[model samples]
Target: MYVAVKGGERAIENAHAWLAEERRGDKGVAELSVAQIREQLSLAVNRVMAEGSLYDPDLAALAIKQARGDLIEAIFLVRAYRTTLPRLGASKPVETGEMACDRRISATFKDVPGGQLLGPTFDYTHRLLDFALDAEGEIPEAQSGEPQAAPVPHITGFLNRDGMIEQEPQGDATPPDLTREPMEFPANRALRLQNLTRGDEGFVLGLAYSTQRGYARNHAFVGELRVGTVPVEMEIPELGFAIEIGELRLTECETVNQFKGSKTEPPQFTRGYGLTFGMTERKAISMALVDRALRWRELGEDDLGAAAQDEEFVLAHSDNIQATGFLEHIKLPHYVDFQSELELVRRLRREAQATRQDQQEAAE
Candidate 1:
């Protein structure tokens, strides 16, 4: 008895117009420029780029602006835009050892090769809101000091000297790209790391938290965390030599986890790795924890049926865009299905009443 809804097209058009007006906000306030977003809200831009799997800060800022500050929507916009661009050549993997670090710290060691630099971090700051920032003023110039030495050695290398840490086997095998190919279960470590890198930050954080709360608890220690810029190089076919294309800001984390000795292996600390665009230490650390948790099978640990331990579960639901698409699709018309269910429920109720009346008459 349900009639199909009409004027949906017009409704959608009107909704879009309203949305546009809402995005712009008050007419008295000036429109936000993409450049301003890129410079001022650089961390947000970094997050969009990291999740979007794209590096252009300007584009990320524009996406943010267009999406009205909704980061997931911005990430989706960047991802969609990424598909249209033609793939050129792949870049050579940048070496993190040679990274010019701005901020470097180690929880495992007191003093590393280069002293731990506490570069721009909010860790020590009080949570009080700085109302002074409400009125914009010129930022004071940062004081410059003696240039620190480069090529800081990884903390894991120290543990590796005596074979205290589990050694990761070096391989030349190319990793499968989740974006390019459909995801298959039982993903390798490289593939898992790649997925985690671009996975939704909040989702990954929650999964990581579950591990610490005794759901497949793996004792994790931050071995080293470094944030800095590294040169990206690519080999040109014409030149026959790798050339430095550009430098990219990145954050890398290495976590040392305790692993019990098994039948085939001696007891040693296993390592979990995380790397992301820009200074996203929390995401990197969470990623490392989740990455280690996912490796329970490979490391010869018990599965324990943990959410983080399930490869299929983690990889399948990690993408916000895919998750949102399916979740939001429930808003679409389901009148036919609802009507059928309604009729079935009514018939069932009538049948139950009739059976009750027949029982009463028989008793009488």
Candidate 2:
């Protein structure tokens, strides 16, 4: 049974008020608006949205402001707020093939149908920080290009046509919602993907790195990586057809892995997929590597006992909110528990000292 600490309510309230003052910082300095955070610190907002499992950038920015730039705390706030929202109708599966891509590239191919559009990337830039941005200056407008009239084809589609890659399974049945239902062991690919997409970015990245360092290595190649806006559609019961609701900026990464076929199948390439909110290419790529690693059993491959391959271990600890909550709880008043432990240790030490003295006296 959990006992409530009764005397610290006033202290807690004062602490919160002090925290609000600290959050505001110097009065001389300009206060940060939510718009600035939403526009300028977009990547942080994206990470919060992805991990929090909520797509509202405005709310994310507000949370960021309230949390005093503590992203994990912001994510915690967003997630807590998300739970109170009423569930609306589910949208139809997003057609990524119809995505209006801003950036699309394939490491495997020299040139794709839609030529590699570099799109705002830091790939080739010098690592040195620009001091010009430290002072107020009007930034020059970036060069614009004509929008591509043709839809960018997925790189994997070409490989699949030649029967080189393993085919993705098709199902119309609605997948289990991990948010609503308790996660069970032996989770299907859909459930696993849901977990990975919303999982802690650092944890996922580390696991992905481990795979590259030969922990259940699945020689993954970036078949394609694309960042774009896709239309979200929902079907109305009154209207027979689905209507476009909104657009979401998404980053998708598809990795082709070498798969020497089993007895029933032919030697073919397998695929690992990752899709995340906004331009989170690093997270998407990392998620793909980890996703592929977790597919060892499904692919009829040997269980290599890698941490990434352990689904229960990965899913259980991947949530930052859950992890931080458990970790931070130790700082709270555990006086009763600690006191019991202290008494036990003291009693054991006293008995041991008494027994030792008696033994020494008897020997003498």
| lDDT (Cα, tens digit) per residue for candidate 1, span 18-106 | 99999999999999999999998999999999999999999999999999999999999999999999987888878998999988899
* Index of the highest-lDDT prediction: 2
Give Cα-based local distance difference scores for all models. Answer: 0.90, 0.93
Q: Stretches of candidate 2 above 4 Å error?
A: 361-364
lDDT (10s digit) by residue, model 2, range 1-364: 3456679889999999999999999989999999999999999999999999899999999999999999999999999999999987899999899989988999999778988988889889998999998999998999998878978999999999999999998878999999999999999989999999998999999999999999999999999999999999999888998999999999999999998986566789999999999889999999999999999887888888999999999988898999999999999888888888899999999999999999999999
Q: Give one clash count per candidate, in the order shown.
A: 0, 0
Candidate 1: clashing residue pairs, number: 0
Q: Please give the distance, in angstroms, between residue 247's alpha carbon in candidate 2 and its true position after superposition.
A: 0.9
